[model samples]
Target: MSNIQKIGNPARQSNNLLFKRRSILKTLSLAALLPVGLGAYPSGIVIAADGVPLPENVMTPDAALKRLLDGNKRYVSGKISVRDFNVNRAILAKGQNPYACILSCADSRVAPELCFDESRGDLFVTRLAGNYASLDILASLEYGTAVLKAPLIMVLGHTDCGAIKAGMKADKENVDFPGHIQTITSELKSAVKEGVKLPGNATDNVAKENVRLNVAKLKESTPILRQLVADKKLMVVGGLYHLDTGKVELLT
Candidate 1:
């Protein structure tokens, strides 16, 4: 099956119209069970596969995370999937239903798509200098989950991050970064404070701490995402992308 047709597509409803409505009504009768807590969706919910294009397995947070890690394994092995972009373009143009959402750094060295080995519509990505979840980034992530139904969110950091380094320097030396670059450092200061207490590689440690803070922020975000997480419909995770090795190490 084509990627578009892999799940029951809602856009194609025009063709069947009444028949699809009838099918939806029938499916609703079997979908009354509420989803359980954290990383699971109720089995009954999987029956109504209309607008959500993700497969039943991919709908769960754990499965979605596994898919990303598995893809990363392929990337680290230098055997990434050979994708046919031409075949997916028309389908993707209609709508997107990404399995995962990634908040990554806006560093040229760290490309989330390449690191995760995901194609065009597989991930909904938001990038910033420090990969921190600012209010704006939180809003975008909420939309990814509540509106787009992305099951998983990952805050990706990296080794030798300039932002973390700047934050560390600013905190230690009381130096100011120029322009709006200071905003990134300001956001990362708390991570620097926590990371420095932990012994080795203070800058790299700060980067990982930054990812952790953002991951916690997303999981605790009010209304939309917090409710989804409590009901087991969504998950938030953290990772550190290794630039030299092309590997993503999941941060605890």
Candidate 2:
């Protein structure tokens, strides 16, 4: 091909790019004219930030919990929902309206979003080794509930959690872990003591106890979380994620 053909190809490409830009701008302008929550989003839903609408499925606390459990079932069955991250990227940039808040363990093997089969903007997650309700974690959860309007909070622990195991070991050996690792063991000491008294596997029992404690704490947390729970506007629950089967068994 001659240099002229190459130069002509560049010009056509430039024109096509300009045309795409014009189409995108036109689409955005039309979106502005449409009523809020009309085209892609449903009506009666409010946005925490401009162009970011809250989820429709989380109208009530029970609904939110059901949605979450359903997601977990899908995860366990290997039928997890397909996600289009690109589609949600622009909207999520403005803000998020996660339907639930998850206080989950920071263990590398356990991921809240994956276990729940949820994508970005679907869950507000805070993590610690023991999944305890630290003051900072509580504050973050409160923001998700009171401000972001998340309907549910879950204290999620996992089987064979390193933190709980370490706590149990510390109790048995009467030895301290190095560095800030001792902090996590200390936080879980009470649960470990209670677990030893309970039947069944001691490690799992301890993990469940830790989740229960945190669930209760979040329910009774003054002002925001407690009020929300009392009003039936929020539900706090506990769950233990099975490492082997990918099943999240809801703790009573």
True lDDT of residue 152, candidate 2:
92
Collision pairs in model 2: none
Q: Could you give candidate 2's per-residue lDDT for residues 97-157 as a string of tens digits?
A: 7899999999998899998898888899999888988656866887787666688999999
Candidate 1 residue pairs in backbone clash:
38-232
The C-alpha RMSD of each candidate to the native structure, in angstroms, is 13.2, 17.6
Q: Model 1 scores what on Cα lDDT?
A: 0.77
**lDDT (tens digit, per residue) of candidate 1 on 1-252:** 533354354332222321344543543442334232332344322222244333433568999999999989999999998988886675555556788999999999998888889888789999999898875676688667765678999999999999889999999999998988888888888899999999898888999989998888788744567777998999999999998898899995
Per-candidate local distance difference test: 0.77, 0.78
TM-score of predicted structure 1: 0.78
